[model samples]
Target: METAQYDITWTTPMCIMTLRYIGLVMDVYDGQKPKDKVKPEMMKTAIPNPPGFLEIAAYGYFFAGTFVGPQFSLSRFRSFVNGEYLENGEVRQSSIMVSIRRFVAGVVYCVFNQWGAVWIPDSFFNSQEFFNLPFVWKIIWNTLWFRATMYRYAMAWCITVCLFLINILWLILACF
Candidate 1:
């Protein structure tokens, strides 16, 4: 548990770096100015701050969920990403259904995350003022942060799923 708290605590910086790298690559990929000329501000939207994790989390729906969906078993995320899935060049009803399901899954996760967030508050840390605190308070600040992190993770995961579905829905409509 201690390790998990530490691991999640740093996702903010990592996600930011990832967005920066991708935005740079994408600008070059799209025939825009070279990465050297790209301003950091322009690409920062892809990776958001910790408190703003929800915004960036939604991208998972597109880049990861749409490209490589959850259930993590389905190869949709990988196959579509690799170009192999489009080899035959066909978009069917089945694909659209998968997209919807991803968003639905995200909705479920969002519900759980919201509920958990309400049940726990930063007040739990107020106990730190007492002269002799329980051993549980050893890392109360860390605990509060951990709960917040879990809530954020859930939001990110769900939003990403929903985003993927939205993208797929758009593609399916475009095909027709």
Candidate 2:
């Protein structure tokens, strides 16, 4: 992975190696290579000296993406480290869909969450005078205020999920 940071040194050989690796990983995470094929640099052997630190960081970012992903393959990981991970037309089209969804979600979350005209439930803000004895209750109102705070965060999650689904749709479309 770290070794691949310098892969821009050449692109064609690297991309071919990447394509082969992606196919290999479809079976499982194989470490062994065929005797006839040309091997790219081994990322695991990278020496993290002063110059290699940035490359190491780059490697970490790629793996970070895998944390949220369902599939895992050593060969695929290695290929991605090289330049085989090319962007495609489906990705561009799905970006348009996601852009629209994101805009709608953002507007609903930011603006609709605040829309109100006399929504007072009466009990929401007022403390019952009957129960005068209590320990340190919140300095602020607990009922509506707390629920209202949580609503904004929930809305944000919905918007993020919309974006995530957009990307997933992009991948599915790419498969065809």
Candidate 3:
């Protein structure tokens, strides 16, 4: 059987959004139950009142997490929107350094991924030359190739996290 590869653009966001919506629905359900019936940790996330359409839309398309995510609950999103993190009406400025570090790490990972891909292209895996390699050499080559592939995901997530941090900073600044 021949394996076919399809260029899927929507599936990633669709899958992420599906999970987010499911979690949101479950949280809303938990909110409808009496406080005593819900788990303590879950109670922290339960929404006693349903969010408006605009709130749901904002959370669903939240730019920082739209592509790759560190999924957060609707309650957390509300708290963020409500400025719950502010102390003395001041936004914490410490995250600027953290964002810078994450951005630098993401750039480094991207560079490594590009460099590695050029030296160890995935096409080499299916080449006849690959089949001629000794077992030990093949194992080593496969490990290197896998690491190269994984670097792409690492780079993406790191950059996504940096974007999240920057978004928070922007929101805080806008409020001041």
Candidate 4:
């Protein structure tokens, strides 16, 4: 029998959601206990009242974080939704220049990763030429190869963060 191969696109979002749900459950459990029994750090995130289904859904599907997350607690989500960060319900304008800078950085990272892949292809590792190299040179090649691979992830994360910042700016603008 042959094993079937599949492309699973939901894995990343599912993993992130799973962690978030687990954290919420643990926080709720902690909240049910006496204050003295909970660690101070845990208490900071503890939820005295579990959120309703709609709130949980909103948190799970939070637009800025649903795809590639810098995962945060439900409390933080609530604070954001409630506009707790705003002073006297006033929305502060985000600096356009800052967002522009972040967008430029993300583009730079993406371009660098593209060039890195072309220059230091992963296929080089499997080639006979790689094995024929001196030990020190092999190490150098491996290091460069690793860095090239990691740049792809770096580019993605940088772009995602830039998007998240833009989303926040828009939300603030819309709310005002």
Candidate 5:
């Protein structure tokens, strides 16, 4: 169980890096080919080059959205590195508030999920002792376990989205 948790932790970042590398390959392939020779189908799946290896590595390891992500495209990463994203920087008040609200809601959701998990112990369901419980109690236990697992996932996703938005907001401010 410990090893499984450890492995799960690295899965997201590795998947993100794998996608980035695949994008890099397609981008390099497209860049090397003559524009006119490229087929329409090929263009649909192609991505442009990221700024450089350093930029690619940075985005892949970015703490904000690495573990649990709302993954951005390679082109967006490039534009961010080159400061082009901020060129038309319109920092709307409502957008800022919305992002802030998302971040707050994420924190609340994470806390609630943690609380729910602790309140309903998984060991109880897996242990031999659970079989002795009343039928209704068993059903309740199963339902709670399912809900707890879902909450864990929802919390992670919400946190990722919150962090991603915060990063974007910071980037806008930093560039200006």
Candidate 6:
């Protein structure tokens, strides 16, 4: 059981690191792309040293957005680590109100989905009554299915937003 848990813990981050490594290789290896074929954005401004293995490991296991991520490119990650993410010396303040609003919205969606789910019989779709139902009723049931499942997506968005909000708060507090 411990082995299984250990495997699960390492495997996910390993996959994430693998993908990030692939992106770095595709960008940095000149042999992978002919000079003429490279896009303007792909051209390195100034040749920077490739990140070391330890740095890559740190970035991969940074714990924020590792599971459900809006993944950043290698270049963006590098910029962030080097403290060059904002060039203009402007810090964007994250609104706690906005975060709270999203959290509230997510909670409402979850509650509504749970409440509505009680009316939806688990075996209803396979039951004869479902087949015997009129076309209008079928359409309504389909709509209900759509509504009931929407909380999952909403919660996912809420979680990501909350993560960003926390990061922003940390940044603000740290700088002061």
lDDT of each: 0.51, 0.45, 0.85, 0.79, 0.67, 0.66
Arrange candidates, best TM-score first.
4, 3, 6, 5, 1, 2
**Residues 11-119, candidate 5, lDDT per residue (tens digit)?**
6677867776676677668756877878886665455442576876786777654676556656666666676765367444335666677767767776776776687
Residue-wise lDDT of candidate 1 within 1-176, one digit each (tens)?
A: 34522344445545654654455345334334454655775443322212134533444434643332332211232345555766477555445566567667667666665565565544545555532666676567457656654755666666666675666767667877
Give candidates' CA RMSD values in order.
11.8, 15.5, 4.0, 4.1, 4.7, 5.8
Give per-residue CA lDDT, model 3, range 11-45, as digits (tens).
Answer: 77778888899999999999999999999999999
Clashing pairs for predicted structure model 4, backbone only? none
User: Model 1, residue 57: what's the lDDT?
Assistant: 48
Total clashing pairs for each candidate: 4, 1, 0, 0, 0, 0
Mark the regions of model 6 whose C-alpha exceeds 4 Å error after superposition: 1-32, 39-49, 62-64, 76-89
Q: Compute the lDDT for candidate 2.
A: 0.45
Q: What range of 10 consecutive residues in model 3 has the weakest lDDT sum? A: 1-10
Model 6 Cα RMSD, 1 decimal: 5.8
Q: After superposing candidate 5, which stretches have Cα over 4 Å from the reference? A: 1-15, 26-42, 48-51, 62-64, 76-90, 93-96, 132-140
**Considering only N, C-alpha and C atoms within 3 Å, which residue pairs clash in candidate 3?**
none
Give the alpha carbon lDDT tens digit for every residue of 1-176 in model 6.
34421233445656766776666676656425666877677765222456678977766665554654556666677677666866586666655777788778778777776776577744677789999999999899978976776765576567567666777778788888
Off by over 4 Å in 2: 1-112, 116-141
RMSD of 5: 4.7
Candidate 5 clashes between residue pairs 3 or more apart in a chain or in different chains: none
Stretches off by above 4 angstroms in model 1 are 1-18, 21-82, 85-92, 128-133, 136-148
Mind giving the per-residue lDDT tens digits that candidate 4 earns over 1-176?
33242222568778878888888888889988999999999988899998999999999888567676778888899998888987899765884667677778778877887787789876788899999999999999888877866766666676666777788788768877
Worst 10 residues of 5 by lDDT: 1-10
